[model samples]
Target: MDAVRPLPDFLVKRYQGWKATTYADNRGWYKRLAEEGQRPRAMVISCCDSRVHVTSIFGADQGEFFIHRNIANLVPPYEPDGDHHGTSAAIEYAVTSLRVGHLIVLGHSGCGGVEGCYQMCEGRAPHLEEKTSFVGRWMDILRPGYERLAAGNEADRMRALEKASVMVSLENLLTFPFVTKAVEDGLLTLHGLWTHIGEGGLETYDPAAGGFVAV
Candidate 1:
């Protein structure tokens, strides 16, 4: 704890400015949110990449989305072994307790985690193959998707794997009993989204079309 340093002046200054403006403009909204607690309608599973901003992209307000971010925006199959499961815990809380109506798995271009999986599966990243690497282990959840796309062009395969990561997460979400029940009862809906970082183009998955379409 002692090793922690104070925040930079630029961050502090910007935060002060933002805080002042936010309170000055939406004082009542802030008060209501603080007093009533959050009732988010959607739970967003997104990447840890700083470039993918859920709020900014969706123009969301505070307390609108319950968000969880991890490497590759991946979700593993439901494993109730009683060990630490951050993402699973978040999903459970969102679905069972918060009763969020929508669960979104968001993927994006040039994902380092997906790229790492591509390298690891291709026998290039030895560190990731090791038992000690956390990122390697996390990206392992996307390996099946990578394998499924192995027959295509290398570049296209990587992009396919990135999109498939969202598919994988969506499939795994159904493995949870509570999630399955909620979804079956029409209490929850799932969505998949992929974005182009540079161009800001977004594509949504269409089950009928079996691919992403411009949204």
Candidate 2:
């Protein structure tokens, strides 16, 4: 694999400038927050795409959200298999430890991870062996959704696959004991959300309606 280098010169210099400006604008607020620790109301699981930044998308400031990211914004089915359960550990901390009031699984259109699922379903990506591709394993949770949504036109099928993927992930969330307990006790709620990156629209999943509606 090729070694990744630092950010481009322009981005590095621009971020340096922004850092100083932010410090000047919120020095006192930052210090107070650092001392007090965080009490964010929500936890968000989103994609690791460079274009999909949680704080910027929500206009959140420091200490607003406890966020986690994975390919395709997926949450694996609860399996305490090994030491490298990064996403699971984050979910445990955010829900059980932090006691966040809401946990949102944020999925988006034009997601590369979701697209990868499409390729796998069609047998297009030969390099994706079941054991090696973490993407393959993580995304397997969405396979049933893809199968159910397989009847429509190519465009419609993609849309269905994307939306169904979110629903499947929501189901996976309930498999986690802490998340299930939180829901049962009425202390926490889970939501599935879809974002239209191209047009900047937010559609939330509605189980009763069986669709994504504007929220």
Candidate 3:
């Protein structure tokens, strides 16, 4: 077995810098969080893309929002087959345990996961179609969204698929009975959001508009 190594020097240095500045400045807040525990009011499910900075986007402080990141920011249908389900577990914890008031699915432009799903659906990504590929299986959750994509050029379709992924996640959230009850009793609200990576622009899903409108 290979021996585990310590963190890279750059990361160590960055952590030291943050500890001296941000952590030092917010020492009391950190202590309070540790003593009181997290009581985040909202939960955000977003893409694992490095550029999708959920905290910076919302100007949120530490321990403010329960954030979960996955490839393409997808949510699978409720399943209790005694298997490992990371995303579902997080949702259950946030909705039932933490009892967050709002759950947001945040999708982003130029998502590699979404692009891969598009290629796979179009029969261009054979590697992702392989049965052994974990990414392929995980991205399968977005297949329905891909099928619902409207007619458009490749770029437009990709953008639409990105948004559709958020909608799909929102739909799947309701598949969880706890989420449905919370939403029905007005304890929780669901939101779908898409953001442009380059422009830093955000749009929210409006059921009345039946499309994304700038926010």
User: After TM-score superposition, what is the CA distance of residue 62 in candidate 1 from its true location, in Å?
Assistant: 0.4
lDDT of 2 by residue, 1-215 (tens): 37888789999998889878987799898898899988899999998887777887789998889999888877878998876888889999999889999999888888887888888888887655477887787777778878887576777888777777778888888999989999999999999998888888889988798889998
Worst 10 residues of 1 by lDDT: 143-152
TM-scores for all candidates: the values are 0.98, 0.91, 0.98
What residue pairs are clashing in model 1? none
Give per-residue lDDT, candidate 2, residue 98. Answer: 92
- Lowest lDDT 10-mer window, candidate 2? 125-134
Residue clash pairs of candidate 3: none
Compared with the true structure, all predictions reach lDDT values of 0.95, 0.85, 0.96
Best lDDT among the predictions, by candidate number:
3
Summarize candidate 3's per-residue lDDT along 1-215 as a digit string, tens digits.
Answer: 37888899999999999999999999999999999999998999999999999999999999989999999999999999999999999999999999999999999999999999999999999999999999999999999999998887999999899998999999999999999999999999999999999999999999999989999
True lDDT of residue 178, candidate 1: 97
Stretches off by above 4 angstroms in model 3 are 1-3
Query: What C-alpha lDDT does candidate 3 achieve relative to the native structure?
Result: 0.96
Q: Model 1 Cα displacement at 159 (Å)? A: 0.5
**Per-structure clash totals for the candidates:** 0, 0, 0
Any idea what lDDT model 1 has?
Answer: 0.95
